[model samples]
Target: MSIEREDLMICPARVTLDAAQMAFFDGLPTKAPSVQAELGCELEQGHEGSHAALGQQVDTTMWWIQWTLSASEINPYTWCPATHLPDTERRDDKDCALFNGHPGSHSSAKRSWQASEAA
Candidate 1:
């Protein structure tokens, strides 16, 4: 099965996942559930500073949400494999995509969790 590429989004708040959010993530795959159940999740913080490359000075701001997911949970969301951007089929949130997919693919609880997340 192929996950879509647009549903993933790096949460901007850099906040920890709430109970509902945690529940949502728990239904993705065995790997994701296990990881969420264990280490939990954390939104990523961006790097701050300047660097020189090729004799040119440049500045950059990076952003992402990082969580200790299992090997199987890696790239579980629908995202551009290369760019990591939301793709055409990607859901607005990971939970939506997770529950929307077949139970054979993952878990069924995520869909209900996503509904709560959206409200």
Candidate 2:
């Protein structure tokens, strides 16, 4: 049976990297062509800083990467392989959203809802 777009749910997958893995990722070529080809999606990476309060332990900086998943890669019955990091452990799933419509596309449902509210 075919599944509709709105019926699908997306979630994020995390990969915690060690020192060596982090170095390898940092040394990757600009634009990360090889990594992108392997993952089948565009990627954007950045460093996320952490803050601590008094008497609390300071959090270490981590490399944060986000990517978009292809339609075929999404599986409602199982967890989708969102990101494939080199030699890292998996973590809990994070909430994700999927937008099917293209930019500037008209939304008939939105219009209908507006009309109903006006009545």
Q: What TM-score against the true fold does each predicted structure earn?
A: 0.22, 0.20
lDDT (10s digit) by residue, model 2, range 81-102: 2333443343221211112211
Candidate 2 matches the true fold with a TM-score of 0.20
lDDT of each: 0.26, 0.25
Best by TM-score: 1
Residue-by-residue lDDT tens digits, candidate 1, 43-114: 112322211001100121111123332221222223112222345242233322321111222211123332
Q: What local lDDT does model 2 show for residue 19? A: 53
Number of the predicted model whose lDDT against the real structure is largest? 1
* Cα RMSD (angstroms) for every candidate in the order listed: 16.8, 19.9
Residue 100 of model 2 has an lDDT of 26
